[model samples]
Target chain A: MTATAPQALATLPLADDALILSHRLGEWAGHAPVLEEEMALANIALDLLGQARALYAGLAEVLGGEDEIAFLREERAFRNCQLVEQPNGDFAHTMVRQLFFSAYQQPLYARLSPVLPLAAKAASETAYHRDHAEQWTLRLGDGTEESHARTQRAADALWRYTGELFQPVEGLDVAWQELAEEWHADIRDVFGRAGLTVPEGPSEGAWSAGAGRQGLHTEPFGRLLAEMQHLHRSHPGATW
Target chain B: MVTGSAPAGRHPREASLTQLAGSVPDPELPVITLAELGVLRRVAEPEPGHVRVELTPTYTGCPAIEAMAADIERVLREEGGAERVEVRTVLSPPWSSDDISEEGRRKLAEHGVAPPRAGARRAGPVLVGLSPTRHTHPAQAPAPEPVRCPNCGSAATELLSRFSSTACKALRRCTDCREPFDHFKEV
Candidate 1:
């Protein structure tokens, strides 16, 4: 392996995070609350999938083919954050999840933008995603008592997994503390405006209950992987 | 590297090949040529009769890229009389709405998709805090510039949705004519 091999390996989890989330969001096609929303979610899913493809393609030289890495990998071999792999529970849950993840992604991409051109492009896309999630969070949180309660619950439930997003990856050069702080401040501000409270708990520190960077995942990930890989695995060497 | 092929001795046919490849219309937005859309990054002949074209997708997951690449290759081989065509996708210096040529913008407006507003590039520090923090300060997002209605040419419009039919557009409604239209969102 070349010296840059580890750097390519580091990108796998980031790519997987996007890939899995794209699949989850894609599941909402034709199932979103409205036609516009359906289009919106699918568009977002497509963007994530695009980012994943680019990242995977960048690693092609080091990791063989992008398809082989994305489709053929076993559950234990896949690297992705637990947050993205969590099931999309409801509209509220999905929106909350999107808000948290996009908020983290926006800043993370911004920091990486200088060194990685893909990050610059992904940063722009993530800006829209973060805005979409924040808008929904506000609408849902302040709209109705039922909506507010549901979104609030979703926010609280998903907070734990967010810490993992701030964890340092091997190749990425980021100030984890600053990223975590910015993420926290952004989430707090959005939640505050939406009439929701930021869930206070253990900060995203060394002791966080996540090893997704090391290939460990939550319970729901295996099923998600199965569905994602089923078609690709079944039709090996198939061309469209 | 072939020693015979020198930079100063580039074949005259190479320029025509570049022009031919660049003239291919984007599969999705037929109104704009690949050159206008800035998707056609570079066209070169590494050796005689072998064309290499580089392209960047407008959006990360734009499905049209495969078709666009195929179209480029087909055109070069069948029409341009090239022996081989290679199309590459480059992500660095990622494509921006700003990359849309003046002609592309005009064509997009003519086609009823509002082109991105000039000088509306999303650059600068994004302030995420509602309250001032040590690293950042409270700042509201910049308001979107007025997108003139592609149909009626009215600036009175309201954003209905941040996303539209395609990944590159946002849904907006013209207040004057009451027509919902697509605004080519600034990336």
Candidate 2:
């Protein structure tokens, strides 16, 4: 079968997560504080891009479409949540974003290795990303007074978004439910290790930004699409 | 984990799968096979003639995994005499530039992409009593002697962007040929 069928991909959740995070990371491509850091962030972005493309390609195969998910859908068709879709703020904000997301991601990936192939791959890369982010967090959080204060501010600003990372989508099967439970416990543990205090804020209900798994999204997605799709949309099937 | 191997001509299928799967050259960097590159970490034959090969990416975002997986399936099916090949991505051991084999590095260099020197010192100076400009110094430093221009055989070249078409390379322009080329960024 070609890439045009409409079958549901098994790894859509992971694919969506990768897609959103890659977009967020790509925003830092040229704007990092240091050149080496720039390279490192770009490398991480590429990793996320790799995961996104593979997952999307797999999704396309299941969905049966000539266009990959990035190219084919309206904004609402995307399944990624708002936290990853939020604009990356300053370096501190970016690090906080990295810290918060990887806290959830690192453990999720660790638990997934024996059970799933894609999860195993995500877990490995995320382990590196987690270490990278955690190091930065401690450096910024416990270092100089200014950096510590700023990191604290960043944490406060971004803490509101953390709840949604573990919030399960409605359609998960039993295996996914079990995985989500493990993900919750594992993520909380990592946060505790990072010296981050888990907020007891109200849970951001499903699709407050809309149901991402079911392809309901918010306003920001349109702008993201325009930039992401500009080349492919402008060139019409052009190959690099 | 094989049992009952009395037949004189029979080899454990897991061993055969591992051997075959490991022998497949990395599509992007061919000097190393998946086994040598650490891309293929393990293989299992849970059922007869159906092999499951586990792989890891060389970089967090290496695009070659898909191609590698396809290639792994193709190579294993042919060599192992298997009806089915299941290639799985194992991400627990994240790939680092360090993972590339010495042979792989040589091949990459021959391919005009400079490979990372083993345990090479980082270009950046550490914090404390270091000039902020220290980080800026290396960008202007002269390209090393063995730096062959991918566009021409001239070693006289100036550094451009450290990141080029991909993160693995840098942009450089040769003075002798006056041609800009991508130098596989030495990790």
Candidate 3:
């Protein structure tokens, strides 16, 4: 709680991204294959929640209240990109989603670190996150026949949603092109080694796909929001 | 009670308060004091008897931060005789694993936990080895040298898991001694 730094409307999307992804990862609590894996996902989720809280704390002045911004807002009000809100389809699906998001987020944070304190603080954490995702992708894609097929399928299904990440937000000064290039190159390198190929669909989220940045999310996002907001909505002003 | 006799009038008090606050044991790694861990950023008597403590978290989501803050406040009030104690969290100059002092590192090793290697972390995306990555470590901090086991100082160690009992630690096992220990991850 450093004196609430005057926040930008731009911080909203970034915060929402972290918060939503955290909830999605949290859904793996008891269901992850092993105990250590369960811990890893939960730890990563905690890190995302921390990043979201830091961003939201900055926005408390403009956004009214932190809990309300998270729990009370409608689906249209949220600005997280479509990729994060997509449900954790399977183990491979979860890893690929993490890979795409963390790859984008790490470099973006590196670029933003100079002007934004949160970004600088989180850059290293995001790097670790990318590492985690990359490792999982490499293993799942190169492992057994079933593992490779499942991993490839997950990558193809999720490829379209990734385009929304590059869409620039207001007030944040960043080289969106450079960030996207870095992400694409890195993802290609990882995928190439993992025996996977880039899907042929339009990577540019045009008008029909991956429009969560404009508050137009996929079908799964609404259900996610419902589950996420239920507790706070059920008991207003609830204290943990 | 012994004032002015010290090197500086205010320094002795601040130093004493700093040591007092730093003496609070870390909730997770009780082997090291907060001072040794290097997280107690400041201890200032803003007004007479009213102490303000500035602390930072090792990791943003570290759950131990609350316990650390509470311990700091309690020790300062009960021992330092401060009328009002306020422990505030500051995130500006975020805490780093490098902040853990030499003595703290020593204590961690003594307690069978590997201390985080300073300056081992590089600044950039890690190039993890391709297909069937053996080690599976995020190449971010490829310890310049192998993480020496605290129990036996064996260079042949394996990383078991990235996240361990706590967020800041990673589990590793020593090849020689066959003892599994927690290596403090360099952030």
* Model 2, runs deviating above 4 Å: A1-7, A65-67, A170-200, A203-218, B1-35, B38-56, B64-187
Interface RMSD for all numbered candidates: 7.1, 7.4, 3.6
Clash list (residue pairs), candidate 3: none
**Which wins on TM-score, candidate 2 or candidate 3?**
3
TM-score of each: 0.90, 0.60, 0.91
Could you give me the TM-score of model 2 versus the true structure? 0.60
Number of clashing pairs per prediction, in order? 0, 17, 0
Give the top-scoring candidate (TM-score).
3
Ranking by TM-score: 3, 1, 2
Q: Please give the distance, in angstroms, between residue A227's alpha carbon in candidate 1 and its true position after superposition.
A: 0.9
DockQ of each model vs. true complex: 0.39, 0.17, 0.39
**Considering DockQ, which of the candidate structures 2 and 3 is the better prediction for this target?**
3
* Model 1 root mean square deviation, Cα atoms: 5.9
Ordering by lDDT: 3, 1, 2
